[model samples]
Target chain A: MKILVTCKRVLDPYVKARVKADGTGVNLDNVKMAMNPFDEIAIEEAIRMREAGKADEIVAVSIGAAKTEETLRTALAMGADRAVHVVTEDDIEPLGVAKVLKSLVESEQPGLVIMGKQAIDGDSNQAGQMLAALLGWAQGTNVSNVELDGDTANITREIDGGLERLALKMPCVLTSDLRLNEPRYASLPNIMKAKKKPMDKKPIDELGVDTAPRQTLVSVSEPPPRAAGVKVASVDELVDKLKNEAQVI
Target chain B: MSILIIAEHDNAEIKGATLNTLTAAAKMGDSVDILIAGSGCSGAAEAAAALPGVRSVKLADSAEYANQLAENVAPLLVQLAGDYSHLVAPATTNGKNLMPRVAALLDVMAISDISDVVDADTFERPIYAGNVLSVIKSNDATKVITVRTTKFAAAEAAGGSASIDSIDGSGDTGLATFEGQDLTQSDRPELTSAKVVVSGGRGMQNGDNFAMLDELAGKLNAAVGASRAAVDAGFVPNDYQVGQTGKVVAPDLYIAIGISGAIQHLAGMKDSKTIVAINNDEEAPIFQVADYGLVMDLFDAVPQFTAALD
Candidate 1:
């Protein structure tokens, strides 16, 4: 069985994101970009599955502009057998991305589709579940653990209260959550080898999916700032303020 | 416009988050009908029908939906999607799991975890860990949305009478089977709905030290939470994690003990009404958002604060 893992090039998680002056979206000028951390976990999980003899190959896919190839290369360095880049300059929504992934799933015929639960940039946890719906496949979102048995994937998901287990049949979709696994760093030798790995680029339009935006961005702005606070010298003073000044206690 | 809210519930009772989602729906006009799909969930349906502003409750009782699998629930939602102009759910783990599937089946893009409903179509949502708030307008005929329950006040649970209608269930797809669940059974208030929240971070040292926070929580009738650093340090379970990746919480009073508020951690609790930060490091980012800051050792301050609460 082959594993198809999806990735995205997002603003590096550590960087402080600033809004554009015009409030249309985030300012991406001269900022560092990296594969989404959750997607990195997805790629790592796929590689582990192959290493455990559960999967034959790992094909990493990323959708965005030319810079996305760098993210695909990182996945290759991490252990994906090959990479596919869907090139598009347009800002696509999750539904559009899911449609495109559906097209790829039809052609790739991978036994499983794995990706991040949500992108750090949009913080919208939709694509993997949407893709599963489009393909009429079983889905396990926010998955923290996975175990393969015959033709089933036993998944442990991090839910609101605690963990819930489910057994999903093969040809399914799984989204990686934070507790799944600690991602591995690519070694220098592996980074050099990644440049030699095969990578295919396909223009987004060629996939024949309606990659159109259904939502209009009205504006973007910083959240309302909280009122300034004062420091309390002692626990007694803090208790006094909570009981009297703030009236919260 | 008619709205269909998918209620999140176990077989016995509806979750509190659904009441918050109901408030969001009520804000967008009042043709709201809640769908309760669970095995032997008439109790949940009755509870939904009693919510203030709910027009009715549609119950789909079936064994296939006992576990609330996205595969089974999404199909049932799609089957009933034609009558409603909007499909809404609370942005809990269950809502986040299933709403997108319903949206995809309807071929409409969804707005997830909206903090503000500007109008029927426009909403304000946080991106970049709440650093940037984006306002959006959807053009879809049937809008799909997941409400950030913490941002909305929960509707009154009683005082309204609405009709209950039994709906047919879409048979299971045989794609997934329920195995088991390990739920944290706690006697304390739930973190999301608690009036007060007291959270710890790595500076707490270890899991054993969390007992101090628990004691403080018990004093104030609060819920205990932990920053991602604390959970990553194995000081607490993942469910105790409070962050952008974990749980979003907005309570009346939020106390942070020994927490150096990272951006992601702040995202979860910054919406709180009154924040109190107790840390030896005066420069901890948690203090920036805190309404009250105390620069002291948590080991010394926690017990004193707990004692002073009375």
Candidate 2:
């Protein structure tokens, strides 16, 4: 069975992203870019399944500018067998991305698709679920644990209140959450080997999916900063301040 | 324009998050109708009908909706999409799971976790862990949205009487089956709605150390929570997590113990009326937000503070 994993290039999670002065989007110039953290987990999960003999091939797909090939290389280094790059410069929304992935799914016909629950940059958390809907397949979002049975995937999902276990038939979509796995670092030798992996680049227009933005980003602004606070000298002072000044105790 | 608010309930009663979503919907327009889709959930429909500003309650009762699965609920919303100009729900797990699928079927974009309603078309949402806010405008004729409940106060549950109308829903999708769920049965107040919240971080070391937080929470009648690091370390379940990706909580009082206050965790509780941080690291970002900061070893300070209260 073949597994399809979706990877995205995002601003490093550790870096504080600033909105552009023009209010269009976050300033990405000179910002360090890396494969999305959750997508790393998805790639790691796919590699694990492949090692366990459940998957025969793993394909990593990414949609972004030409620079996204670097992200695909990272996935290749992490153990994906091949890479597919859908090159586009537009800021595609969740629905548009899902449509593109749906096109890929129809063509690839992979037994399973794995992706991140949400990108740290957009935080939409929509693409995987929307793709599943488009494909008329089962989906497990925010999946913390996954066990592949004969023809079904038993997935443990982290929801708002607790954990839910679901059995999704084959040809399903699984979105990885933070606790899914600890992503492995690419070794120096593997990073060198990833350069030789076959990577196919395709134009987004070829997918025949509408990539227009359904919503317009009007402006971006900083949130109201919390006022500067005081450090108490002792626990007694803290309790006294809480009781007398803040009145929250 | 009329708005359709999807009610989040448990068949017995409506969750507080739904009421908050109703509050957000009422801001968009005056005529707000709530859709209660669940098996044997008339009690929840009654609760929904009583919420202030709700014009009517639409009930879709069936076994297909017993679990409120997205496959079942999204199609029903799509089918019922003709009457309303806007579809809204709380940005809970169920809403996040269901609304995008509805938006996809309706061929529209779903605006997620909107914190403010600039107008019927425009909304304000947080990005970059709430450090930055983006104002977005939807061009779609029928708008789909999920309200961030923490940003909106819950609507009053009493004083209004709305008529209940039954609506038909689609049958089972049959793509997936719910095996079971393991919900943490706790008597303490829910983390999101608690008046006071006490959260521990990775410094808690192990799951057993969370009992110290539970004890302190008991004294203050507070809810116990954990930072994402603590949750990832297996000190507690994911439900106890207070962060951007986890539960967004804005209590009256928030106490952070040994939490270094990553931006993600701060996004969840920074809106609290008062914040108290106790950590050994004086330079922790949590201290910057703490109204009362105490730099000390949590293992030593927490027990002493509890004893002092006793």
Candidate 3:
């Protein structure tokens, strides 16, 4: 069966994000971008499923501007058979992105769809569940472990208290969580071979989905700063301050 | 506007986070109803009915909802969608799993993890791991939202008693079946609800080093937590993770050892009342938010701190 994984290009988590002076959005100019950490885990899980003979072909998909192709190539180097890039310059929201993914799912007919639980940038945590609802399919969000049976996938998800396991039937959606797996780095040879992999690019309009955003961003501002306090000379001094000054202990 | 809150429960009892969500929902106006969807959750319904500001409780009892599977719960919520103008829940794992599905089925955008309710249609949410706050205005007729419970105080669990009404369930979708669960059985308080939390980070190095944190946590009667870096490094289970994508905790006293405090990790705990940082690196971001900073190796500082508490 074919497995489809959705990858997103996001500002590197290591970089300090700055809100634009105009308060429209985050400043992305000259910021290094990489595949979202969660999406990287999704791609890694898909490749592992294929290696285990649970999947026949792995198709990696991404939606973004031209720079997203680099993320798709990274997926290829990590072992995706091919890739499809939905080219768009517009800043699509989670619902819009889900609609596009739904259209792709209809056309591709992949048995399973795996993607990140949320993008590090927007942190909406909505697209995968929205796509599952649009398709009227079973979904396991924040999945940490996945075991494939004959026609069902047993997914263990990280929950508030602990882990919950569910057996989702084929043609379901699964979102990767932090504990899913340790993502493997792309070796130099694999990176070289990824250039020769097939990459198909399509305009966002071609998907035939209404990509309009329902919510308007009024402003973006820096979070209230917490004033740095003084460093204690000794542990005894820290305990004294906690007891007397801060009174928290 | 009438709001329908999806209560997070485990069949037996209601979660405190649900009460916090009620606090947020009550701010959106009056006539708030809590919906309890679980197998044999009458007790949870009773708990919901006792919450202050809740006008009523809707109970959907069915075997299909035993696990609160989104496939079944979303359809049930969509069926009951017409009565309420807003659907809200605490931004817990269950809420995050279920709300988007309900929103998608209802054809509305779900505003997630909102920290503030700006009027009825506008909301404030954090993005970029809480580095930036974005104010959003939703045009959807029916707004779907998940509240960051840490941002609001939990509504009183007992006071005004609301009537409980049983609601019919939407039949199971049969798309997914619950296998089982592996909940971390701990004597310590839950991370989200704990008054004091002791967290470790990548500096812990390995799983074995977490024992030191457990020792300190045990002494302080604190819940143990870990940064995303510690969880990613296999130093702890995912449940111990406290971050933007993990559990958002706002304990009264938070102690961080060996944590560099990435923005994501800080987002989960920055709301903490008094943060204490113990790290060898003075430049660690954890120090910025800490009320008390101790620049020392965790291996030496943790033992001394724990002993000092004794």
Candidate 4:
């Protein structure tokens, strides 16, 4: 009953990312990097699953450059038993990432895989579902609750209007959404122990997955800024502005 | 290019987001067909065919599609992939769940939540919570896309006489079973498409305080929304959330009461035509984007504001 979780190095959610002047991408040069917030929740869920005696071992996997090892270390510190880093300098798209994960899933044979619904950086929100499709496994995306019942997993997912509960067979994929759980901070002792944990690294090419780019990033630019307006002194002034000035009401 | 829009519906009527996705597909200047997949959904298929730019409607009626399960729906989409150059859906949670699987099965990459259709193969989408916009050019033979409904105008619901055809259904895939759902029952206008949106944040204090917003919204005929902090505090359900991860809304008038807007929350409503913030904290960031700011406690200003509407 081993569980596999994914972690990604991303620009910290707190910091506003600045687009490069040349319309290429965000300037990650010396920007604060941390494990994607949602992935932290995924790792935390896997740790809790093990703690509840639902599974035996937990493996944290990441795909990125060398900096991704730091993210995996953070996952290890949080409670993953080991780490796997697929080294690639290229910023792989969701399909490529899913393909690489599929390769790893074939080799690792974990019973379940938990991943962040979307990386706040790309906001693609595709890899987990794509991986499930490729593997012909059941998928629960944007899931807030997971209860494993022997070979079946009961999942509560966030949908457009409200919540939906589903019962999925084992060997499924679950993508963590907000409200899944509040992620815990790694203790100093746990961080030191993570430094000594087993971490396996492999080149992305070794996975034999086609890491080709299907989309060319044409440009990146800041969105049109909203102009600030004057402050109204009272609620009556606000209502008058809404009625006469803006004429929205 | 021929575009196949996967219609979002509940076997009763086509959702408004489907019309918005249709508008995005129509923007590509291609013939657009819609696929309506649900058990006993012929009514929806007929309605989909009535959309202004629809060329035809393909309906797959089966119990397997009742819940819109990704595994079952993706196979049906992949089965029909050969006839179209692009597969599109609105970026609702269901579409977001389904399209990637379809794209993966077709061995193509999906572009999610595109705010603009640059061309047949290019798109513009928001990244990092809409602070930055990225233009992308896809080289895939079959482009799979999910449209951000808030960004596009919805296609008109009528004026087309497209034919509706019954398509072969994709049977059950034994992978997942629908247990149940607890959708919030609301008679009010949907938050995303409402003319006015009234949202509260952590300043609202507790769940009981939302009654003030409810009364205000009732008078204004506006939808009620909550910030992530409010939802996280259990003051409201997740569906009440209005943010990047929640529902992106761009109503005509958006009133933020007691909401110290976070970047993610602002991303959802900054496109709104007229923004008003009511918070005691004059330095709240919500004021920066607001068209009119009122520095007053929500408990006082909300009731006064609601009374003024009378």
Candidate 4 regions off by >4 Å? none
C-alpha lDDT (0 to 100) for residue A99 of candidate 3 = 92
- Higher lDDT: candidate 2 or 4? 4
Candidate 4 residue lDDT tens string, B1-310: 9999999899999999998998899888569999999999989998998888788899999899998899899999989999999999999999999999999999999999999998999999999999999999999999999999989988899998899988988799999999999999887899988999999999999999999999999998999999999998999889999988888999999999889989889878999999999999999999999999999988889989889988
lDDT of each: 0.92, 0.91, 0.92, 0.93
DockQ of each: 0.88, 0.81, 0.81, 0.91
Docking level of model 1: high
Off by over 4 Å in 1: none
Q: Which residue runs does candidate 2 get wrong by more than 4 Å?
A: none
Residues A63-171, model 2: lDDT tens digits? 9998999999999999999999999998889999899999988889899999999888878788988988888888899999999998899999998778999999888
Tell me the tens digit of each residue's lDDT in model 2 across B120-235. Answer: 99999988788789999999989999998989988889989999999886999988899999898888998988999999999899999999999888888899999999999999
* Order of candidate numbers by lDDT, starting with the best: 4, 1, 3, 2
Native contacts conserved, per model: 0.93, 0.76, 0.86, 0.90
Model 3 segments beyond 4 Å from truth? none
Candidate achieving the largest DockQ: 4
lDDT of 4 by residue, A1-249 (tens): 999999999999888889887767899999899999889999999999999999999999999998899999999999999999999999999999999999999999999999999999888999999999999999999899999999999999988799999999989999998889999999999999999999999999988889899999899999878887889999899989999999998
Relative to the unseen true structure, what is the Cα RMSD of model 3?
1.4
Q: Please report how far candidate 1 places residue B192 from its true position, in Å.
A: 0.5
